[model samples]
Target: MTVTDDPVRQQASREATRWLILLQEESDDPEISAEFDAWLAAASVNREAWAQTEKAMGLVARLSPGNTSSWCDSTGGGVDMLRQPRRRIPKRAAWTGSVVALAACVALFFTAPSLLLRLRADAMTGTAETRVLHMADGSEVTLAPGSAVSINNKDGRRSVTLLAGEALFSVVHDPAHPFVVKTGNFTTTDIGTVFDVRRTESGVDVAVRSGRVQVSGGSILAQGRELGAGGGLTASVAGFHADERSAEQVGVWADGLLVANDEPLGQVVARLKPYLSGMVIVPSHLSSQRVSGVYSLTDPGRALEAVVQARQGSVHRYSRWLTILR
Candidate 1:
């Protein structure tokens, strides 16, 4: 049997396909591009695996012009077709091949590190899946969908690195072992608190549910702000925003609902993208409009429709995976 027939190889190819799709969707982000380069440099296996997957996808594109569903399936059946030895192709059939070639080019040009980070994370949550993890030190962490974190505890120091998405942390008080969460350039150290940390494309956001926490790094206003209960801080490349909300209201995404208070449509779309399976594109004109609502994360499509409808905009869905808000 060829490599594609092997279960391990097939799984890798499936995962690689997902990464390829995501990278293409977010090609405009420079941070993602840099992270992708780092991921490619981190391991030889990653490059090899991606190359093989790309080759197989190319073969599929050449053989089957427009119907990607046949070869994009994750059941290894698509790879099986590519692996067959006797498939013949005519020299000149006026093949429609530009879209497939463009997809491959985009995938190669915009590989993301999120997939690699998820593979290496100690714990992760899949699309629309939440997980509550109990740490060895009696601490608890609730991971939002599409989130990943790696834990390390040694010599009375406990820490976790938030690789992607969001997480609500309930850190146990242990003066001897301070609990810290690292996301991007920012580091949040818990002062006996329950807090939420979300890593966005540009920066990090910290919301304290109870107790207090210290946030440092990344153009933070006033040098490592200490936020108590019901306080929050958002540190981004543009600047920072310090706000206040109820302790119970923090990390509301964990409850299957997203609460947005006068947030822009673009930001709301960005927040909802991780929960949905595929691409949700909002036009630049509609993205700047303000939106405020308690939308259900469980039904992202319906929630998006509601948000757009309020502004007299409409949502056009080409497929279950592709939705365009205009």
Candidate 2:
């Protein structure tokens, strides 16, 4: 029988939903023990519900703490967090399915089912909107203005396909499944870590923060390269290589922080483009000039001002955009 239609399974689903809300509340307020006690007393099913939810949620926690929504099991089968929605619980075989599901859930539940920890995202961001996403793996992703991405959770892997613009990924570590990120011409994989990928006019730019990543030209090219901690790479149709500063620059948006450690003035302007209100253009003469230091993304104008003062560069504001000249 379908889980929603079965009496016992229906009860479990209802109880699980209630516990989800309770767990979120408890996460926010840890001093609710007495409240929890009262909740448990409200129904004997409350405890059972809590137990089942705990099992499911725990599975998610073990697998990936970010995508908890995928663990709903309506068929009364013991809960196992999955990357996709559970198949409909068959009606005639309810008893058998529940037994088998429970057994499988227990085996899979030990490590947190990979289901609830992966996300399926298909979205587009407009010119004015900046999109922020929390992945199932406890990593955060921020899309630049006017960007789009598609996230897929498959049986063996978690993948993100960036359709346009730039994206930052801070991935949580899971040895069982590797996280893969794809852009127009590039594909990057991570066991667990953070990085940024941007599509530039000429080619793709990749920057790394924590952990390591392997970048291969996706479908566009024949080969890919690996990137280690603090490594950055820039590639076009022509080629790819190791870059030290670019990787660090890509992560600037993750914490609302910005930094340019001895990087070109032009490069810094390119990195700052997303945070500022208008275009930031550095003159060709200063394009190769190196700049260094940390700035706040919250105040790009101040950061711009600092760059001008320290580097003897002049700033010109025209409408919403700004231009810099040495």
Candidate 3:
């Protein structure tokens, strides 16, 4: 059949044939298996799409070199009666169009990884805590816990939206693709440097470390800037001026390290939540007790011991859970 002869039908046939070839070539791949399973699970339309392609291939396979030569030239399927040639289709091109379809499938299979990587590059992070991801494009992002961000690359622009929690990002030298981070009411963009951000009770907190970041009017600044090496900027929900401090104390959780530099006992307990399964309680009054030391995140026990000794506070341990206070 020519391109114009039932073009829609032919296109569907080609697509279905392509997928069949893809399935055969990637039969061993778990994803392909899953996709096929899903396809098979779907309604009859999918099956129809497959059947049409198979039919097209069947027609091609039935043609011989002489017929194929004529078929190619005629721009149509021509049946010459008197000069009939033996219908021995070329092994390479004929039959169910399987060979051609399969070749296309094989080519696509090799390229699938790269395509998937591009999709994945859009956005992903882990639980219990967020992460700082450095994309291939050099854009940096601080992923919040239980949050997924998708980066859409279109028309020389990169855009990201936080599906959950919050993220603070500092975009690096990508003038071609302006970086945009969107979270509910707040939207922030980077000029090219360092900045910290997190979702708060009201809205979101945005603080620039090196480069500047623009926080929309809807932004909810951090309660207080947790300052140090890489501290946060805490601003009141209503107030504009931010209390800037080293964000290292809270930021260290990414490495599973909870560093408290003259931090209150209560705040330290809050930092430990991401690493430990259960809660660590520091009574309201004890929360004010200052703590200064380096704790081995891998072994919270060791850090607890040092803190207790240094502050003359007591330590209570209960099945992987601990409480420390003066």
Taking the candidates one at a time, how many backbone clashes does each contain? 0, 12, 23
In candidate 2, what are the lDDT values of residues 19-90, reduced to their tens digit? 455444344444554566577687766666656555643532122222333233646455433333565432
* Candidates ranked, most accurate by TM-score first: 1, 2, 3
Q: What TM value does model 3 have? A: 0.46
What ranking of all candidate models by lDDT puts the best one first? 1, 2, 3
The sequence of per-residue lDDT tens digits that candidate 1 reaches over residues 1-326 is 02223466555455566555545444455786676667657666656666755664454212233223232332522232223357643222112133344444345333455568757799988767899999998899999988999988877779999998999999898877789999988899999999999998788999999999999886555378899999988898678889997788898888888887888998888888777765778888899999888898888767777788878888754333456677
Candidate 1 to native Cα RMSD, angstroms: 15.6
lDDT of 2 at 50: 59
Candidate 2 structure lDDT:
0.63
Candidate 3 lDDT over residue span 36-110, tens digit each: 657645746556656545454443312232333222212233332223356544333343353444445444554
* Reference-based lDDT, each prediction: 0.73, 0.63, 0.53
In Å, residue 274's CA in model 2 sits off its true spot by 1.3
* Top candidate when judged by lDDT against the true structure: 1
Output the TM-score of candidate 2.
Answer: 0.54
- The superposed Cα distance between candidate 3 and the true structure at residue 182, in angstroms, equals 3.5
Query: Model 2 off-target regions past 4 Å?
Result: 1-131, 144-147, 154-157, 173-177, 218-223, 245-250, 321-326
> What TM-score, over all chains together, does every model reach?
0.67, 0.54, 0.46
- Who wins the TM-score comparison? 1
